[model samples]
Target: MHAFIVTGASRGLGYALCQTLLDDGYFVVGIARNAGPALEGLAARHPERLLAVNADLSDAGQAAASVRTALQQLPLPECATITLINNAGVVTPIAQAGHYPADEVVKAVAINVTAPLLATDALLSATGGLPARRRVLNISSGAAAKAYPGWSVYCATKAALDHFSRSAAVEQEGAANPARVVALYPGVVDTDMQSSIRGSDEVQFPQKARFDALKADGALSSPADAARKIVDHLVSPDFGRQSVVDIREL
Candidate 1:
């Protein structure tokens, strides 16, 4: 059996991933703050396969601990692989570095950087020896590599996640049941997050026009398209050959 634990699974790419995984007969534990109607429909269709967990990832420690306990308790059958996709993230507080509210800044850090790292540790400890191929996919961004004027917090958090993958991948390599980790950059997909980007205050995000143009020209990839490519890579034989991947490059 293949088990996939996905965050932000209520909608967008995360939801698409859950659907795709279930269609292929895999078990999915979807972690979402507000497990929306779409996920509800998925649960209705695949009752035995999809488990939606309602937990806000902003409280990273609590959410991680909760999922760890839940998975450890479930009667999950033997698995070929157990994959964790850290897809929950916030691209908010879009303003110059010093101008963001303290709370928003802290919240973004928790959701973007802290949550994925904690969940990675939690999954490794909880899954036991059931699956030999354990993999972690941290949803990162190009902002991690190239800085944007108003995306200080977003860029920094993604960079932290990417660096964390580098260190964790090496450490996992030596463990008894090592889990391969990759920090992937899923290019500009037309998710609600992209909508938020387009709606940002232009004075703060000067590059908003580029994203606007991308939308106007139909350049953004759909969530389903991106999710399919991502899942294909996740299950491929050479899945973890690299610690970082950009879907566009694939």
Candidate 2:
């Protein structure tokens, strides 16, 4: 059986990805801060195939442990194919670059950038090498490319992740059994993170217009639909060695 690891699987896109993978008959190891209601429902449906691990990816040690638990649950010997979906991320409250809290920015970098790299390295070590047709998908955001005044930290971290994914793709290219690494931009979705950003005090940040427009235009994609598309790309024959692809283009 093929095995997949999806981080931030409690809700939003991560939860959707886990559910979709389960439907496709793949064993999934889901790591999240807490087992939210949506994930609890999924676990009830696929008790054997789903392994829910609660870990704060921002905590370096916890992040590494989560990957180890996932490996233990789905041994490399038993599953010849493995996929790592670094989907967990955080969007700090909208604040001007100079005014943003240092602690919050640190947490954002730890989870959005450092944790994914650590998790991928742990998986590679545990598996000994890349699996046949292995793939590592980093969930990124359009913010990585575009600049929004109050979202500096969030944008910077995602931009770092995108760069890391591209560089890792090149490193994996020469491996005896290479893996395709792709940084995927999932687009804006109607998620809790959006709500958090929208409800923040705009007077201090003065950049609520973008959030307001997203809500007014109903431009958010459903997590389930986005998750399906992400999975399709991961499993596609032509996934090839491309280092980056925006979901909007797919």
Candidate 3:
């Protein structure tokens, strides 16, 4: 049996990925600040296979503890593989760097960068003796490689995550039970994050028009579609071959 851990599992890509994993009979630990009705319903149907953990990713302590708890209670007798997807992120404080709120800046970094690293560290320490095929997937974005006027915080955070994956993968090389790490760009999905981007102040986000056009042109992938593509890559033999990947390139 496969065991999976997903963060930001309340809605959007995270929720869809949890549902997809559950439907395939995989054990899933879902961590979210709030579990919406859809995820709650899925949890109800598969209580044994799906574990729901409530944690605020904005809080570093909560973020790390959630991973420990998720791994601790994971039924591991038949688990053959374990994958951790750090999918929770914040695309906020959508204003120019100088005008950005300090609090929002901190929150963005906590969610986008620190949480994933902490979660990866926690999972590594907790699962050291589990002897399973382990992988850490950081849900990244195109913004990691591009510069957006008002997304300095978001871009910097994602870039940090991508670089972290590269370094972690190297560090884990040749270990007895090493875990593969990859930071993947999942493309522009029609999630709440996109909606928030569309609503940004034009003065703050000059590229708002481009994103608006993507939505208007019906080019954004649906959450479920994106989730499926991502899971396919997650379970693929070629997964983690590239430390940093753009799903669109696959």
The candidate maximizing lDDT is: 3
Question: How close to the true structure is residue 66 of candidate 1, measured as C-alpha lDDT?
Answer: 52
For model 3, how does the per-residue alpha-carbon lDDT over 130-207 read when each residue is reduced to its tens digit?
878899999998889999999999999999999999999999897889999999999999999999999999999999
lDDT for each candidate structure = 0.87, 0.84, 0.92
> Which digits, one per residue and each the tens of the lDDT, describe model 2 over residues 29-49?
889988545477888899889
- Pairs of residues at least 3 apart in sequence or in different chains that clash in candidate 2: none
TM values, all candidates: 0.95, 0.94, 0.97
- Ordered from best to worst lDDT, the candidate numbers read 3, 1, 2
Clashing pairs in 3: none
Off by over 4 Å in 3: 36-38
Model 1 accuracy (lDDT, Cα): 0.87
**Model 1 CA deviation exceeding 4 Å by range:** 36-38
Q: TM-score winner among the candidates?
A: 3
Clashes of 3: 0
**Considering TM-score, where higher is better, how would the candidates rank from best to worst?**
3, 1, 2
